[model samples]
Target: MLRYVTVSKNSLHDITLVALIHDIKFNLIKLLQ
Candidate 1:
């Protein structure tokens, strides 16, 4: 059960990181345009 909790946490962190990177890229593209 504890392992499952940690795995979920890691996945959540990865999702957030990807989302942040995506947002940054989008903002940069808008700025360039």
Candidate 2:
């Protein structure tokens, strides 16, 4: 159970990071336009 929780937490962290990167990319594109 502990391992499962840890894995889920890691996945959530990765998702958040991806989301942040995506947002940054989107803003950069907007600025370029």
Candidate 3:
């Protein structure tokens, strides 16, 4: 149960990081345009 919780937390962190990176990329593209 602890392991599962850790894995879920890691997955959530990765997803948040990906979302942040995507947002930065989108903003950069908008700025370029």
Candidate 3 lDDT tens digits, 2-22: 999999999999999999999
TM-scores for all candidates: the values are: 0.99, 0.97, 0.98
Task: State the weakest 10-residue window (summed lDDT) of model 3.
Answer: 1-10
How much RMSD separates candidate 2 from the native structure?
0.2
lDDT of each: 1.00, 1.00, 1.00
* Model 1 TM: 0.99
The whole-model C-alpha lDDT of candidate 3 against the native structure comes to 1.00
lDDT of 2 by residue, 1-33 (tens): 999999999999999999999999999999999
TM-score, ranked from best to worst: 1, 3, 2
lDDT of 1 by residue, 1-33 (tens): 999999999999999999999999999999999
Q: After aligning candidate 1 to the native by TM-score, how far in Å is the CA of 27 from where it should be?
A: 0.1
Clashing pairs in 2: none
